[model samples]
Target: MTAEKANNLLEQIARSKKEGRLPPVHDWHPPFCGDIDMVIKADGSWHYMGSPIGRERMVRLFSTVLRRDDDDYFLVTPVEKVGITVEDVPFVVTAVQVRDVEGAQVLEFTTSVGDTVVASAENPMRVELDPQTQEPRPYILIRDRLEARIHRNVFYELVEMAKPTLIDGVEWFGVESAGEFFRIAPVS
Candidate 1:
């Protein structure tokens, strides 16, 4: 990315962060400024011009303005929008916090970019098996079509908390969070 372009993007994100809220990029209809040499890799690392973004604060700031439209990702502000590449998803679930509220289990996920979201109907978790490896790839919805891939250790924690239950005549292993049962795998 060019210095001028990076500076413009950083300036806008800094302003939005200072307001303590994200700007409504979904509501804004700005002209696309074409693609930039930026990519959010599958492991949640931010790269610009083929180099990893070393600053945590800088990555966090850029994440706030990220938006997904259809299959494309963009860094959007009110006045400008620039497309970027994402390998898998934009975020990664770094940690999981399990809590009990009135005997109901609640799973809270902390994203790499520092956003926390409770697993519920609004923010649901799903697991998809990898086609080649057949291993489960779990993800949790964050916000506005963005999802976080659950870390391996966190997924192990979830598996430990899972219970066997029957769903629609099929035995399943899953966990309940926020009164919703999310099936992790079907018992054989």
Candidate 2:
């Protein structure tokens, strides 16, 4: 997304928030509004490069497990769901972009399967679950150009934490340890 478009989106989100309204539902993830922030590291987790700013913003971050036909894709649920899974996932593709580095831009979709643990209880048939087996699938594609990095922070954070390093460009990760790196505000 371009800076202009992203700024417009932020304006729309701010308006919705001021009126106590929720974000409009889109093809990608279900309409979600919250305080979203991301810290980008410039040199492989060396330091913070920059971050995005918004109020009661729309969170568009997602993870895709795999791809099929034209629409037979799987993604994760919105960030606000009770339990994250492929079934809890939503489908959306608001914008696309290509970074300054080589290679095509990676699209992040939400899936139903995420950090969840299921244990089987039995006297002699106890079984443990594997976490990697539950990772969301990915749909790698090629698209020309890229969208405004408006939600770049959101997408950056998602890919940083979920997807692996593909290029030597900017990378994202959650603010778990860098608590001081992120700042959020309540929705109106």
Candidate 3:
């Protein structure tokens, strides 16, 4: 993408963020205007033209306008929907807060983009084990089908807090949030 076009895209998204209290990207049905060179790396960093987008405010603005249609991701406004590449999920859960609520532990995760979501039935946590490396790829739903991958340290914290539960007579290790138990792994 040309510098002019990239600047235009930024302006459009920034304008959209300014117009709405919270960007209603789900309501925007702009036409697909083709792909942008922006990429969201696995580490939750945004890159444009191969350089990291160091502006935290701008990144937060872009996150508001981000949308996912099926498997593809886009930055949408009332006028345009521009595609972007995502290595894993679009955000990373960098911090976590845990509290007890009515005998249940509620876990709230804060993403790198400044969005916080409490894990529940609606915002469930899931872990995918890599077949080759056997590494755990943990994620939690943020909103509207967008997910944030749990950072390594945060995941370790979760594991430390996990309790073993018996499901169907099988012992499984998991965490509790909002009265729901999300299985992280089954006992070997």
Candidate 4:
């Protein structure tokens, strides 16, 4: 990313943070400023100008303005929008907490960017098997089309908490959170 573009993005982010809430990215419709060299790697590390962004606070600040439109991701402000690359999902679920809510299981996930979300109808979990590797790639909806890739250790903990059930004609092993049962994998 050019120095000018990077400064522009940071200024917008700062202004949005001062408002004490996320910018209305969904409502912003700025013309695309073309793709920037910024990328969020598969492990949820942000890179700019081919160098790792070492500051946690800056990464968190940028994440607040992230928006996904269809298949593309952008850092959106009310007046400008710049596209960025995401290797996998833009966030990673670094930790998980399971609690009893009204006698039902409720799983809360903390993302690498420090955002917390609960697994419920509004923020559902899904697993898709890789076509080539056949490995399960699990994700949970974080916000407005953005998802957090469930870390491997957290996924394993979820597997340990799973129960077997029959959905339609297929038997599956899954876990329940907030009274919703999400299929994690087919019975093996």
Candidate 3 residues 1-102, lDDT tens each?
A: 688877787788877666556688899898888998899999999999899999999899889888999999998888888999999999999999998888
Residue 167 error for model 3, in Å? 1.1
By TM-score, the better pick of 3 and 4 is 4
Which stretch of 10 consecutive residues in model 3 shows the poorest summed lDDT? Answer: 13-22
User: Pick by TM-score: which candidate is best?
Assistant: 1
**Considering TM-score, where higher is better, how would the candidates rank from best to worst?**
1, 4, 3, 2
Give the RMSD in angstroms, all C-alphas superposed, for model 3.
Answer: 1.4
Per-residue CA lDDT of model 1 for 150-185, tens digit only, reads 989999999999999998899999989999999899
Residue 6 local lDDT, model 2: 41
lDDT tens digits by residue: candidate 4, 139-174: 999999999999999999999999999999999999
Name the runs in model 2 displaced over 4 angstroms. 24-128, 133-188
Q: Predictions ranked by lDDT, top down?
A: 4, 1, 3, 2
Model 4: residues >4 Å from true position, as ranges? none
